[model samples]
Target: MQSKATTPTEYIHELPDDRKEVITKLRDTILSNLPEGFEETMNYGMLGYVVPHSKYPDGYHCDPKLPLPFINIASQKNHIGFYHMGIYSDPNLLEWFTTEYPKYVSGKLDMGKSCIRFKNMKKIPFELLGELASKMTAEQWIERYESVVKK
Candidate 1:
């Protein structure tokens, strides 16, 4: 479910007790592993890690007012959703994550183009997710985003 909360802290606090811990952990994982130059903010009603306009003045093409979103974590209706733009934009990153997922979690990876759904909270691979978060820097994401958008 999309949160109406303004800040990440507020978003986590608004979640149900059952979801609060996991989402908090996921937020922490992303924050701890994310490379420099990315800022944490609420984007699209989720806890978003973005390339702020200070780093990329053009902002997101879809809406120039919003920052370049790199990653986002949200508490969904039935599952926790982790969205990573790098995995969606880069085939090699997608292949790497898909190949490595089975090694970390027992169940099949439930994923969309950019969103990874974790139905079972206990099995969420925080470590692997952290690695994925660290894979792309803000500069790299700006380059990748421009490549796809400018095409």
Candidate 2:
């Protein structure tokens, strides 16, 4: 569940031992494959990777004071959330995910536009997540987000 933690490290620290492991592994996998330019921080009571205001001074269009959110990882009440902006904004990536995910996960790929709900961490496709993260750069995400806004 979302916590009161203000920092990513604190967020990780707040997790119970089991949750810590799951988030840690996910965090590590994302970090290893995350394209250059995104910065990791805490956002919305979860761990987030964002395009800092320094890169896009206007910041998130919805909230100019905040950085542009790229991806988020949160421990929720019933499950874990792996939020991917890339998939939400890019159809090809979403298609790739839909096509490839069944191979790694045994359960239904419970998901929304961007949030992938994981009932069991073991079902998470680690390598696929890594590849997804690696596919988008901060600039690419910014361009995609801006293009959507323009439309």
Candidate 3:
């Protein structure tokens, strides 16, 4: 999997037709609410956004080029996954998501290590998801991701 994100627009252009529509809407929500230092790119064969090097030379845990805290919108054989770094990186955020998601959604939204999987985009709460995306700095996010994954 590649580690760098090319450009937000280009990333969307690369998605397959069925995935493109959902991911583009998801991408737009994220871009609209991005924190100061975030950037968009293509990594792991998916569209991703990260905290750029300018904000922190060593992004999110001192790994400058690592894709530690990113959102990966993927089109899998069975479903789509809206991977939010915040889900792995923040206890508070994760708790909130689990609690509130069901209240707002009527369909399936599966999760695993920050990856929010949904077979249909109709199930996602795009605005709430976007707000969560804008919540933390890459460094803080890395701390959360590492805390969970490193164990």
lDDT of 2 at 28: 98
TM-score of 3: 0.77
lDDT leaderboard ranking: 1, 2, 3
Over the full model, what C-alpha lDDT does candidate 1 score relative to the true structure?
0.93
What lDDT is obtained when candidate 3 is compared to the true structure?
0.70
Best-performing candidate as measured by lDDT = 1
C-alpha lDDT score of every prediction, in listed order: 0.93, 0.89, 0.70
What CA root-mean-square deviation does each model show from the true structure? Answer: 0.8, 1.2, 3.5
For candidate 2, give the lDDT of residue 86: 82
Candidate 3 residue runs with Cα over 4 Å from true position: 1-7, 59-68, 142-151
What TM-score would every model get versus the actual structure? Answer: 0.97, 0.96, 0.77
RMSD of 1: 0.8
Question: In model 2, which runs have C-alpha deviations exceeding 4 angstroms?
Answer: 149-151
At residue 66, what lDDT does model 2 achieve? 88
lDDT of 3 by residue, 1-151 (tens): 3324466566556667776788788888888887766677765667777755665455545454664456777666677777876777567878988887877887655888878878766676887788777877666655655566444
Put down candidate 1 lDDT per residue, 45-134, tens digits, no spaces. 999999999999888988989999999999999999999999999999999999999999998899999999999999999999999999
Query: In angstroms, how far off is 95's CA in candidate 2?
Result: 0.2
Candidate 1 segments exceeding 4 Å error: none
